[model samples]
Target: MSSTPPVPPVVEGGPAGSAPGGSQSGHAEHKFEKWQMKKIPTMWSRTWAHRGKISFGLFLAYSGVNIYYARKQQVIRDTIPQNTILHWRITDGSIVETDTDKGYFQKILRATGGDSPSPVSSLIDVITTIKRAKDDPRIVGIMANFSTANNKTQQTKTLGLAQIQELRSAIQEFKEAKAKALGGEDKVSLIAYTDSFDNQTQYYLASAFDKVYMQPSGSIPLVGLSSTVPFFKTLLGRFGIQVRAEARREYKSMVSPFTETELPPPQKQNLFDLLKGLNSQILADIAKSRQRALGSDPVEKLNHLIQVGPFMGSEAKDEGLVDGLLYKRDCGKLVESNGAFGLAHYMRVTAKEHTNKLAKTGEPSLVVGIVYLIGGIKRGGGDFGANTVVKGIREAANDPTVDAVVLRIDSGGGDVVASDTIGDAIRWCQDEKKKPVVVSFGNTSASGGYFVSTHAKAIIAQPTTITGSIGVASLRPYFTPEFFKLIGVSVEQFFTGSSDTSLLHDLEGAALTRYKRQIDATYSDFIKRVADGRKMTIEQVENVAGGRVMNGKEALKAGLVDKLGGLSYAVRLAGDYGLEVHKNAGHLSSDMEIENIVVKVFPTPKPYLQQIVESMVGDEAVDMYVRDKIHSMIMRVWTGDMMGLLHEVGLSESSFQNAPVSERILDTLDTELNPDNSDIPDTVEVDEFDEIVSGVESVKSLEHDCDIRALCIVGYTRRKSQSNNCCMRGVEDRRLRMLFEQM
Candidate 1:
């Protein structure tokens, strides 16, 4: 949803191709801009038909080019002046609240002195920067851009209401802090600039700033929210792929695709309630912001404009929706007093993280550990490996330096067993260790995401965050004989032990009664967890459960979430809680040097190469991360938990057609997620007949240790040595030494 526009040189003219007064042919034309390489291989490499020689030549050429560009980017970053306005354009890549950083890749790059310049930024990083900007006297203001797009689609279309809520909270926090610092004299400016606002979420984010500016020809598509749930029942019938499953309650309709063609009453109600709740929050926020923008009844103005939306730039400006109609480059002059730069560049100059780096040396510190639980929940596969997540939590909680733990969650839920396991780990961290745990919700934290967060002392969510799908489902498949015959295949069943084997097939009569009882028990447990965590009654939780999703405001009203805020608010709370821990322990005094250190929890990726071996494939599905996630759901139909499975599965389907969206989503995060780390692990076993509680143990092999260096560098070492290749440990590789005097 986000992009990283290169550090473009500021020219005197308007946007790249536009004239001073660019005219639209009704509207601007949309063009697909795929990244294209500027240069093609030729000359010496081509003459040598041998593949080995060609590969070596290309590597050398690539190395030189990479070094040159990296050095140039570094030089530019180092030269940026203080008191500069940072142009923070929004992108999906940066909008995400990832659970883990690409540590494996980070290690390799650092070791080789190579550069892995990721344009994507984690949501916490952005929030922390905004918070710091309030106190940094040298920092002037933030120009939040929503118009980062190509000729065709706006990359920020993925910026949903939840993300906007997070951004809005951060902006509000910064503004409040700045207000206090200035003693009501003046304000630190926050300007929202964009060429167009096609999405409701974008508009909501822009509304948070002091002022909003739009392109002369830009339009605002302020239409309400809608959700689509396509049923594949008819399609499956046509293909003779009979799918039979059952849900615990009426609203648990995730398996409706395999059963019903039409929307069930409960599902319809659930979907509508979620959408309407989101829309209501959006309107309310805009109304509040606009009320402040205008002295009179601007809320009425907003209500009126919303009803007659999709307004053009001139119309929006006239209606008081936007402050001005100007090009993006033109906004630079508004904030440029001393000097200015992009936030990404500024971040690099400031060591790319918020730290007390400038504090006097040897200062006492209070460390806070930040553990991200991003993406769909899974048992040792996909991005959110169960083992990996648990290991991170344990390490962070046990670390003596870390006094508090912040679990930043941006998932939409998945595997029930996996989610519960993560939840258990959170509780273990809090109860076993003295660290106070806080959970921060991202754009979408529903079902399993909510499950994992139930045990935290505090939970923070954005006003528009998708939350509270308090439900459980078991969608084990029931294959009909005729369906198997159509595929020209047959499977014979042989059973021992229990006489009651009918439950393994489909739901009917006594079997269904037993199944219902099982699901009811699981759902009850889920409700109790939420109820206990949120300090609510079982009746209250049940009233909202029924697979109903709610926005952050609705969640707060229901007492499911403690606060309506973003990751920054959660971080601050964690710091406060940490200080309280220190204070309670009698280790703190008013004058004591107490600095809060923020560290990430991403120990290592669990068992990747084994999945590759099990699948017996190379990088075939490497580009299909989203497809893999969805496909995994299809395969997991036999294991129930359908509602949870599909909660976050839709994220990948949107961009799967153009290319591997998953690969891009995990940019530089293990090099296309390493085909070895393909999802679902090797086995998903239901331990001791506990179908709702599956187990996936970590599996590591020699093949999993395979990394980029092993493939690229000719002379490499697996063991840590005093002298190594790539000029690491003050020693260069033999190949490098031969090619160049010094590496």
Candidate 2:
């Protein structure tokens, strides 16, 4: 079935016509043909013979493409345009203490522009750019766009008033540098352009600039500030939920919302004082900034303006609140008449100039470490973890290269014990490691935040910073079974002991008495810490104690703070102190000057690949991903909605973001007081105060440190002997279980 061609057979000589000489010639010719076939090469053989040449060709192509990009980037770096206006669009989530602290996934998201990088600019970035521009001949002006600086919708990411003050301080520095450079009036213009001024804080920032322009359609709501507190006692009572709480003093209003239907007299007075102090600050700053424009009586004029109304663009211009009324595009044109570039672009182009200084030989360099502790202080790892902060400080302490540490803190406080943990670490860093630790308070470093900063070499806070609040409070909620019964959900209690310490039941009798004792001990410890650190008597500390929140100025006067300034001042002071240490040790000559002050931020940023891996599998990722899923499932099962789950768990969204950090801490502590695990040990040792210090050691870093002094009390009179009475033995057994379960 196949069509095939047959091969010709080889013959010994020429076929048919044969002479002996012809046969010999044919055989020679066949041998020659076989040799020729062996000499010629196939395509595969040729390619194999010249493999190096092909690889070289590929390498050259790659090198050429890389060279092209390198050269292109270099050109941009070399030739930044002259008379450039640096545009700073300070949008929501734009300001941070250190940009490099972001994790790898966040950087990649920013780099890819997938999430549209949120105009982020660190405090150092803005300050450095302005500082460098002050001397740069090419930079003629700075145009700040604050249209998105205070995003109302994204309240968590919005700029704080203290941050605004920090930026304004940088602007002030720029102006001073410009004046010194010109040896005359500052020629460089600092202009602020926004679509609108929504509040006094925004206007307060704009007031610092030489020229403030607003879109004609926009309005300036330069209204004063007001404080509001919501009481949930009546609302919770409707559901038969009662809160049992205690504060060391009356002014510790952290427990007020749960305990009272309305603001108590002490809380009302405390809030009023805070508002009054803050208002005085606002009035003073605005008056100073707009003094010339207001002619005489600037403070009086500002007070009248704030009281009268929020003004339209034209009205604001007329009232001297704004310099002009202009559209965003027109304002941009005016500022960028010569040339313009973004703050990022300018920094990129000039980075080589800054970096080259680092390479200079024979320069006296001072290394200062910067640690950002910016959130509610707690335990475990996060933005404001006591452990995380301790690690950063210890990293600086361990590093020979790090001469001093600058702790930049922005928090409203969280856990007292955790705060003390951080404070102890700071003490170790300074006293044991011989390092100077200076604190720079940001917007809201109060209570536990200040507690951690107590042992620092120096403390600096911006005039607008909210600080102080030196008192302790604790709250525990009890859910009545009667409420569940009313909702057709009967609850029953089953225990093999005489007592139950469950959150469902209220603490009373001995338990309540012991809780108050714990509060007193903590308050006394707080007072002692403050008195020792601030070099004040017990009475002096007590006067500023009692949970009274003060602005930076008042705190400085009260001796709670050493100075009133910003982060820059703190860094400088830290450097000076380091230099002083060196001088006293005979390391530096009196005539010698520091050529550079290098700020090394701690803890060093993690590698990019690690960041990526962590983003996927890290504890934070797991907590967020798994916890959200579990929360969602539970919400669906109960209410068929996921929104009110936080509220149901005794927390609202505001409690997470805006509540006194103690509120969140108390909520977490309430859970740890009574746990479901039953493998608890039968016996544990108690300390001299009848406190289980050993038990405290066994506790892992919690979200916040629970006040275990009272919670750790055993039921049998804190003795090791077995209880002979049956009821006492039962009580002892139950309390022992509660004690270890807390851990």
Candidate 3:
């Protein structure tokens, strides 16, 4: 046992103005000494006090300078000076996370109290400057530095497969529109540039341009697509971890990554089929975009190109991948010399300047809201991928001018509860507000994503849209002694309650029965929700509810979707619905109320700190922590399934934010110690419901020990009743026998 250390005595000055180590009578000296001691803390306080003032002064000064520069830029842009070429620098990897709304800077200043302007704000200023230049006939051609703007993910996911197809279709529409706008299609010329053209998605977009240029050193990697599923079973097994999965269909390969060493035969076949279909589509698109006339031999030509070694930019030009090879500076020259005002210019001229433009534009007699649902469905109110779509719908419903809503869904779905909440919100908008809602599938909308869409009046899907996955799956793996056996470690859990032991392991005795019942109930609820939405019986829903994949076309035939069309079709339908409402209401209009102005004021991009933190703390840890805290607080009032229980223990392999403290602590220790071995247990048990079941089991055991006299008396009474009514006695005996058999 260590003893406590002695406390030091405090030293005091004798009198005011006297030095701490000097005579007691000098007041000035004492004051000076006192001031000296308080210097650091006092200085810190003063610095903080003046810091805001200094920052404000600097901010105002900067704003004044920016205003001066902006005015100058605008004047230069507007002056119809001849040979004034506009250079639109498009740097590679320059993706815009946010757009500048009109008067955004004023809003930003009011909210953030900062001098430095944001990127989006600067971009808006640039756009405004360019718009001013648009009227100047002397500004001949617009040159974009194409080295930037390589957003592969956004190009693929955000634009989506359907959107891309629509864009391609739009080109044909645009050609007709261009002829109407420019007198003829021949007057328009499009030019595009790139550094290296390895991005297939980017190349597809580039193909829309009349001419594409690349650097001499740049190479286009136009090889066929390949997808690899990394098997982690061996690694998990080495750590004595087992992944248990129960999926309804052979093609439900999402869990195969964790449980199996390699793809099962059924899963392999499914994967191959999917790959073949996807690759075929890709090949077809490439042939169409490239204008290659290989007929049925396009794949062979593509393979031949891949077999050739190191095809440079010039070679790509020869092969028709690009029109020419040029340096970065030459793009400006090309634009000034030969570039003509094309469809891109028209888009730039007419593109909606702000999100609110839809409402403000005078052309709209009746408003139809296009609620963009494009993210994950999470529990709480902030944006989570597709859940944002629901919020958009709610906003649309409240808008008086908005008579109808179109939910543009493009997601793989997320939390079940979130999906339910979103679906309920849509239903409320429809029933309470009497608004017509339509759901439009973009790329892939399935599971929870599809669940929300079921509430719509009509559902539309593109040909390639992946729509149906009418099932829910929960994965829970138990560690037990297997983990301890590998590490040569053991744990002893002690508790007073008979049910407490169940928490440390899988449910046993009464706990198992209760757990099974909970799963059945939750599953029943899931089925019922779908049944109600789709106008099917619960049993009918279950028949298709077992995790099976279906394409958009298949879903329509199965009554999962109402129509097969693109986003434009959905929008048109929404407009039609809105028009019907307008005609019925005699063109009555109302104002829409926007919520949480304070939150919207500073619509800053997600902070880097939060992104870093999320990356470090795995989803399992966060999910477990949230679930455990919620469970402790509302144990008595809980009504969900054992599926939620799996979430509490970090056993469920789903992405959520309720991480366990144990996991966080372990992560911290692992980082700090830098040990060769991790001390965390391979598995954790999460069955808090076991307690309720144990109590039930105890009651059942007591019933079994009832006195023989009591039993005999009951039997004698039953025999007398039987004598009075033979039919009743027979019915009672049958029921009793059934009950006894079940027990």
Candidate 4:
């Protein structure tokens, strides 16, 4: 009423006192405010609620899928019959012979992300399971799926021909024993499956099987043979990566790959001779299999087939290269259909039967032990390394029942010390236990692999087996200047003695001379070892010591091998030795410790929430991510070494697969020891007492009393230093102290 008294005039579009437009605008604002008030809260609540529901639903779905898959797998496993079919999946490198229930469990654990079990344990489990099934009356036949090839090189190197032959021999022996127990009936059938066969090593294995099947889409690449090594000196000239190499012998072609543009005349001639010999063997085997009189002319026929077109599955069968073309699933069905039960059902039922068979009939009264030396000859124990083989040999020697031993070697060599250790083990087995040892070559038993095998009583090799590489060489790239220039990384060293930290730098002048001298000494040791084992003069060993590659025929002629046979021949020799030992003895005990259980199981304590969180966010995650990064970086470095500029421009076939825990640990160790880092973690507290004691014992056994005394004195000095420091000493301290004071 008071404002009305002061009534003001309204303008056309001026303010609240204006005409129609002003009033309408005010009304529209009021309406919008009311609408927003009604809609905002409702929309916000719905979106938030729906998002949570969707997330929960997705989580439930993922859990359901995992549960369904797990249950289905369990049901399938339970439904399968026992002792039906044994599927041996051959994995290269750390190939575990998983044919037993325990082996299966271990493999499943490894596949799922559990601690990896040792390869021997896996093999032992398979053997135990097979033995148990063999004794079960419900079991009918045994079948195997062999997919491993001896030639495929791994991180550990290729499987030696001797090892493959031994494995084949062992399988045969097991089959024969099972058949005899089953009233002389052939209840076992060996079946091999592969995409195609090319190398002589694989072909030899396929020939052992009762029936070999090839995939319809796969071609048996049975082209004669060729070994090509393209030198890249010219290619690298453009990039300025000059390669300097030296070798002792004219035939040594190990350095040819990096130095030459193509094979040298002598290398070419050697390869041609090797190809001619290998081709003859391949044709002979094919002719025997197909019942054809094909001779050296088979190469021409093979060439004609390739020129026409890529052969299909049925075409391969028609050409007599394969027995039949079948899909993997169809092959499984065929195996199942032949028996009274289905494949899955048979596997379940027969698994139990075989387990019982293996248990009842243990190893024979006179045990003939066979040690598998497969893969690269690494320094450490486990799998196909030198330490593993040596350990196995020692175990066999200690066993009174083990009258003879067979070494199945398949490798291209690795560390020199590892090879020497294995050789020493073999010598110990022969001299101490007086056990006759036979060696069988599978694919390639060259260098360190051959070094160990030369100590055996008899050596057997396949026709295509590659042997002989008595040489030593090493290459280490230096990135000091490059890394400093590219990244701001820097390194400095302080030394108190001559040659201190010398190995850390590039090899040049005095350093290079020292390195060469070390290599020569190692080479001399290698030659001496071979000469001792082969009972030849050092001069004779030197003739073949310059890293010369030899096929089985040439190796045999050179007195590197004694027989042209497989693992079976080696085992048979072992059995003969065992029989001889038994005959010489008055009586033998019936009971024997056939197996030793080395596996242990314990329940894992529930992890605390904090522990789990820390593991996820702390060192573990950093370790994993950093390791993967480093592995990729290292692989890139290696590719650079192998392909030079090609890799730099992304034209090389280099890859970094999932990084392993071991690689990560190595990276962490490398980082911690980096020279630029001032604060290095103290590793002195680690309890390496057992390792020290073991090393001392091993040295005593390998060397003279004078050497043992020297080692003991060195150990005393190191112990005194550690006592004085009050701080823990590490591997470096022990190594350096030993070097200065002892051998």
Give one digit per residue, the lDDT tens place, for model 2 in 1-743.
99888756545655754555787788799998987787665656888889899889989999999999999987876676887778777666677776643676766666574334445667766776777888887777788887755554332265677787887878877777776665654577788999987667778878888888998888888777788899999988888888998886878889999999887898789889888888878888888888877759988888888798889988888888888888888887776566778887677666666767677655667889988888777777764577678768877987888778999999998988788888988898888778899999988999899888887899999888999989898988888876786688877787786443677878888878777898899999999988999899999999989988889989999999998888877888898888888887798887676847777888766555445555668756744443344444432343332123344344444643454443433333323322463323334332122223322424523543333333233212222222232222222332332322332
lDDT of 3 by residue, 1-743 (tens): 99998755434645454445555446678888898889978998898899999899999999999999999986654333454444443422221212322333434432463332222222212333344344444443344445534433222112345554554454444445444555665544445677776555556556655567888898776665456999887887777676555554555566788888898887687557654555555556666656653345656566576567346887887777777888877865765654233223333443433334544753344456665555566775343433344546656775656767777677777777888877887897889788888888877788778878776788998656776666655555556577888889988876676642343365566865665565566556766777777898877766656555566666777778888777666766776766666567765443422211100211223333333333446434534443444345333422342234334433342321232432333233333222465432222122211122222223222323332222222222233343453222222222222222232
The models' CA-based lDDT, in order, is 0.65, 0.73, 0.55, 0.57
Clashes counted in candidate 4 amount to 40
Error of 2 at 213 (Å): 1.1
lDDT of 4: 0.57
Estimate, for each residue in 684-733, the C-alpha lDDT of model 1 and write its tens digit: 12122122111110111233232222111111111112122212211122
What's model 1's TM-score?
A: 0.65
Which residue ranges in model 1 land beyond 4 Å of their true spot?
Answer: 1-83, 99-118, 150-157, 176-189, 241-243, 292-295, 335-338, 351-361, 485-492, 496-505, 531-537, 589-597, 604-743
Can you give the lDDT of residue 133 in candidate 1?
72
For all predicted structures, in order, the TM-scores are 0.65, 0.75, 0.57, 0.54
Q: Write down the TM-score for model 4.
A: 0.54
Superposed model 2: Cα runs more than 4 Å off: 1-59, 62-66, 108-118, 150-156, 183-186, 349-351, 493-501, 616-743
Arrange candidates by lDDT, highest first: which order?
A: 2, 1, 4, 3
Q: Per-candidate RMSD vs. true structure?
A: 23.0, 15.6, 23.4, 19.9
**What's the distance in Å from true for residue 405, model 2?**
0.7
| Tens-digit lDDT string for candidate 4 (278-319) | 666655545554444233465456556545544566776776
Ranking by TM-score: 2, 1, 3, 4
Clashes of each: 11, 0, 28, 40
Task: State model 2's lDDT.
Answer: 0.73
Model with the higher lDDT, candidate 1 or 3: 1
